[model samples]
Structure formats: C-alpha cells, structure tokens
Target: MPYATSAAFAHDWPDTVRLVTVEGAPHTGAWNADAYAYAYAYAKELAAFLAQHT
Candidate 1:
C-alpha cells in the first residue's frame, strides 16, 4: 500500500537509485508510461544535482 492519488516515489531498494512507478488499472501495481516519463524527468533532475554537488 502506497500513497496513491498523490504522486510519491517510495520504496526500500538496495541501490543508489530511485524508481518511481505509477499505479495503473485496479488491484495491481502496473506501470503507466506517463508515470515513467515523470520518473525519468525526476531521475534526470536528481542526477544533475548530484553531478553538480559532487
């Protein structure tokens, strides 16, 4: 169960990475293409920031 309705990328992963997956359909955690686009944008932003910071 995640915070749906509001876009939030929450997951406990074992990597220096973040994955955002949007919900699709019912009773499932399917991936929406649009959400992936957003996630890609977010990842780019983060990467840029880290690159600048480090």
Candidate 2:
C-alpha cells in the first residue's frame, strides 16, 4: 500500500510466502474509510487465507 516501507517488505517476500494486495487501499486499509471500502469482505478473505495458511 502506497509503496511504503511495509509494502516494500511484502514485495520482497520470498516465493513461498503468501502475499495479498488490496488495490486502492491505504497504509491501514482495513480502517481506511476512503480506501478498502469493503473491509467486512476483506476481513472474511483474510480469515479464510489465515485458516488455509495456518
């Protein structure tokens, strides 16, 4: 998000890592009102991802 430090880390993650990118999202996308508007759905997606990964 925003090509910031955290985003750079995610981008540099190894191939085995799971990386999810929310388009048009801000730094803290889940709480950003103007960005990631569908946060409830995003939460569900994140939960599913964690469930599968962990």
- TM-score of each candidate structure, all chains considered together: 0.38, 0.43
Please report, as a residue range, the 10-residue window in candidate 2 with the lowest summed lDDT: 14-23
Q: State the C-alpha lDDT per candidate.
A: 0.51, 0.62
Kindly list the per-residue Cα lDDT of model 2 for residues 3-37, writing each as its tens digit.
46655676688544444555676556645644445
lDDT of 1 by residue, 12-52 (tens): 43244354444443323333446566567668868886996
Q: Which candidate gets the maximum lDDT versus the true structure? A: 2
Q: What's every prediction's RMSD, in angstroms?
A: 7.3, 3.9
Alpha carbon deviation, residue 6, candidate 2 (Å): 1.3
